[model samples]
Target: MVDGESEAADIVEHYELDYDESGRITRGYQQLELVRTREIVGRHLPPGPLQVLDVGGGTGAHARWLAEAGHQVLLVDLVPRHVQAARALAEEGLSVRAELGDARQLDIADESFDAVLLLGPLYHLTDRGDRVRALREAGRVAKPGCLVFAAAISRFASLFDGLARGFLFDPAFRSIVERDLAEGQHRNPDRHPGWFTTAYLHHPDELMSEAAEARLRTVEIVGVEGLCAWLPQLAEQWEDPERREVILESIRAVESEACLRALSPHLLLIARRPG
Candidate 1:
């Protein structure tokens, strides 16, 4: 754990974080996440022979694609298990490598990478100082004009999820949701913390402000899986190409709409290190 954050590495290992990448892709909403993230990241990344650093990139899901596309990628995460899994990709001859590392104190050289990703680190860091330090480190390692992509769980995500899944009926869980809505902190105190570990949710504006505080120029912040993806029927239609495309088109159309973005479960902030 960092100075103010929880023992996030132990939690990640206990929860087996490696399943998220593969498991999420099976759900329709997560399918939207996969599609949109790749689309947005692809649009901004420079082509070919570039060094990309995936800070807190779990299990090398994004690293694999980036490497396959001819970029050299190095993924660092706190969980040793995730590092091992990511290293398996490197063993298979992809231009990728993974190692155990912390986002708050990166050992890599400054201005060393063409792009840096803080996709999972911010969500777990509850303290403001820790989050800022992580972002600044990302900015420090990135080339002056390069992009940094950071992801955050929306403040009201769990509230909406609880309502959708009927978890609100339980008094204990309802209280938890209320606390989450009030403070944006999600803590699992029980011995069995379930699938989700300790995390800090973020308001859309708050996430952008954090990036600016790190001196990273804000490019754009958009919802990964928009409100429409929450519909119950979306999963059923995933197998139908026409229906899936229509659903994806709808999500992409409103991804940047300010009012609608807060309804998304996850938000992405794309910023650049100032030249």
Candidate 2:
């Protein structure tokens, strides 16, 4: 309904989020999120020739990974450009299909896939009702078993994140912060044609509460990156081997604590349809 996915949507779309040259998607707080997600969905299922609906999955990163690993993957995004980009990646024969679609209205049959991944949509949708609708749609297309979602937390974590990693921000983000503080919530200027995406910070409780409404039971909730995201400068410094490994262990250790979870840059939750 709204243009672009939301603020969160723009963040993912605008950035190059794939694993770096080192072959990892995240570190520190996010380690647990990725670890737990892969563990639950990875171990529980039979070899994934399984059907997977990767909603709001930009650029088919996860879709390509899963598809190449032997699952049938469908990656959808709201932006036409995203679809084209993913399609280009799929041309290499990864058993992945990319389509342009909205998360609030998924054109999928009931119980169609073994898993549904809503990792991006929740961040952009600030309204509780709208987010719940997206969750309901995710539940609609998924069979009763495993589904996972990810969201970015609210700015309250900004204090920790700003301190831990140093929140060197994009010039675009300043306006967003001003609008959010003043108007309760606001969108940044349009980034591209018909694409009005920006960040929408979230309360962790809101995420859990919304999932509850959709009848999706919470399994595991973790952050994508805790203090590490704040330290983009340090992250760049980790180009060497020793520093990277040290960081890997250091961040992985704290990924589970309640305090660390609260301040994570992106929050990831793995939920399932109740039996």
Candidate 3:
């Protein structure tokens, strides 16, 4: 295992006090992330029935949908519980395959998948070298010219989250936010599961740089939640269909705006391996 990997896993295991991987993206502002990510990734994906490798795909959230959409999906995750949950989905008849694996060192054959996803790996791979190694593995597994969708937490995410939910009132959270803004390293030493886990939030430029270093050509880096990430009434708004559409449209309008990308909680980097 790489440095910090065990700590990250321990933190995530602790985070189960708040919610598990299955229910995480199904509610609140996180729903926006799930919705927008599916929309954006679906938009870029080639015609279906393709082979997809979902690296660090916790509990097969994306893999379940991709499989239902007719693509063959193989999901790899470090957490055994998550892998078991994903396998449970397969037992229910979805065609997703789940296995325990590391992102920096995939056990699969090279150039085997039509598309690759590194949605959760980058968030936990706090080391720059490890993150780049994960990206390079994504490239190595993807067919030439195929798209790779990588997700990252924005550097400003903790600050915005703290402010939005009054987490900043606590000095501990304030210190965590400070470090996140100053160095992009987020460490939660407290026992509060809501404080999240060890993560390396990324500046937009840093994500682009890492992808470039991995020899992946940048197609675009778009904000997943955009300006709607921290809205106080976002949950209420999401319940109303029309309001949700307006919110999604508003986000899409500025999803790619460089100045506003950092305002988002999560960013998705769309890159392609050179043919």
Candidate that would win on lDDT: 3
RMSD of each: 2.2, 5.5, 1.8
Tens digit of lDDT per residue, candidate 1, span 57-88?
A: 87887888889889999999987777888898
Better of 1 and 2 by lDDT: 1
Residue-level lDDT for 216 in candidate 1: 90
Off by over 4 Å in 1: 1-6, 17-22, 26-29, 191-195
Relative to the true structure, candidate 2 reaches a TM of 0.75
Name the regions of candidate 3 deviating beyond 4 angstroms.
Answer: 1-5, 8-12, 15-19
Error of 1 at 202 (Å): 0.3
Q: For residues 35-130, what per-residue lDDT tens digits would candidate 2 score against the true structure?
A: 444543465455668899888776665776678678988888876666777787667978888887878888888889888888677766766677
Clashing residue pairs in all predictions, respectively, total 0, 6, 0
lDDT of each: 0.83, 0.64, 0.89
lDDT, candidate 3, 1-275, per-residue tens? 33665755664575344457788886665778788999999999999789999999987779988998999999998887788889988787888999988899999998999999999989888889999999999999999999999999999999999988999999989999999999888887765767888789999999999999999999999999987878888888898999999999999999999999889999999999999
TM-scores for candidates 1 onward, in order: 0.93, 0.75, 0.95
Tell how far residue 253 is off in model 3, in angstroms. 0.3
Candidate 2 accuracy as lDDT: 0.64
